[model samples]
Target: MRNGFKIISFFIDPGAIQPFVQNAGFQSGLLQTIVDDRWSETNRDVYAFWPRLSTLYNLNNNQPSTWWLRNGSFLRLKQVDLGYTLPNLKKVAIKSSRLYFSATNLFVISKFKMWDVEMGGNGLGYPVQSIYSLGLQVNL
Candidate 1:
């Protein structure tokens, strides 16, 4: 908060999951949702991890080379508000009035890919939202 302005922020870790579980289903399972580019596929070599079934025996291999520790940490501006009270507005038949502008979930900075790193499961969850608003207050 500063000069009649205030701001609040929030974020979640969305702890990491098995290398391929978030987006890729079990190797034997028929359902797979490739939600992020970091997930491994059949032949794609780019930032890809082993498919779900392939890592069944090696679930503990969470090395830097693997995308498991993809830094779920995120920073969000969250909300901000600025207001100013007009000098005695008695002349206008008003005692006091203040104008303000605000915003919520303004922006985010994160290394995790997909909708939101905090969503955890390769972007399968609903994404955070951003909102803007303006308002005025008066006291007679």
Candidate 2:
């Protein structure tokens, strides 16, 4: 079962043009409505598959509907941390030392490909950032 919600306004809604660059090959359900030789009388069930691109453009200007809703479920590798403690370093005048590494926003797995699903309907918003960090600690 699907959970969560995403309004795909930024991607599919022609009325809401995006300010940033968009992939030329980005395929949405709207693409399925582009009529071609593949369409025939038997495929009359296909609603609004217009023979002309202009007709499709006009249809897209309508208000949002259930067709624009998509499952927002996602799995994300939010963060990871690793650390190692060094043995006593009396010879070097240092009593102890340790090293550590950390990372955040590593990656995300989701069907909503337009942007981070957590961003929700705001596709124009900046996506979550990935961060990596390394550190050391010493005690004299």
Candidate 3:
């Protein structure tokens, strides 16, 4: 399992003076709901349990807590390779021939929706890349 250290920074941190431009984070939608329902009590059913944005902003002054912690465990299909070898061909003077296909970084299964668990902490580093390869080998 991966641990989240700076995950709260991705949301509304105490040092963040300017408004966030992107609203793609996990709490963005919930924050938006809080904003939209601030004036209407009827519209607060979705997040009635959550505190207002102002309250959360004030709470940000405190140190990070378990609230920001996330389960980053994941199951990934890291690599795969398949190959077939042909029988010896005396007529063609070929002792052995083989064909192979290989692939990497295929897929991941995880409850961590924010980012890849393998990336560690904030997951801001370069993303994992997918690669596919095919090859043929012949011995004559």
Candidate 4:
């Protein structure tokens, strides 16, 4: 018999390197078209030029640029599980049992906004969700 009390066990899975396309941030291609009501043309500077809506609407003659690509790299916390095993319940006809709580897709720290970073195509997809669960396991 292993003469020791099983205290705590933890499992963590940090998922893969996900490269995605994000378009909701300030680095969007339609920056001038999506500004808020407080936006002003006078706010334009030498470095940040605000294009008129008509100018942007007539941009079929312009060439595409890579200036609107938001960095979509992040380390995601995929899942975390914490569990505790109870001592053997010999009299109850139960050998051992464990209770555990787990969570998935908990959080993401990214520069992108209003969208999930795992879609990876043109940034048009459903967002990811966080899930939580609790369970028990027994060995008889």
**Per-residue accuracy of model 3 over 1-140 as CA lDDT, tens digit each:** 11211111111112212222122243333445335533335555643323333544455323454444545556677777767776668789888887777778778777556555566544455778879888888898
lDDT of 4: 0.54
- After the best TM-score superposition of candidate 2, give how far the Cα of residue 44 lies from its true spot, in angstroms: 10
The superposed Cα distance between candidate 2 and the true structure at residue 20, in angstroms, equals 19
lDDT of 2 by residue, 32-63 (tens): 32444123465554443232234335454233
- Scored by lDDT, model 3 comes in at 0.52
* TM-score for predicted model 2 compared with the true structure: 0.58
Show model 3 residue runs off by greater than 4 Å: 1-58
TM-score of each: 0.57, 0.58, 0.60, 0.63
lDDT of 2: 0.50
CA shift at 29, candidate 1, in angstroms?
A: 17
Clashing residue pairs in candidate 2 are: none
Single out the weakest 10-residue window by summed lDDT for candidate 1: 22-31
Q: In candidate 3, which residue pairs get closer than 3 Å at backbone N, Cα or C atoms, i.e. clash?
A: none
> Which candidate, 1 or 4, would have the higher TM-score against the true structure?
4
lDDT of each: 0.54, 0.50, 0.52, 0.54
By TM-score, the best candidate is: 4
Candidate 2 weakest ten by summed lDDT: 1-10
Q: After superposition, how far is residue 85 of candidate 2 from its true place, in Å?
A: 0.6
Candidate 4, poorest ten consecutive residues by summed lDDT: 46-55
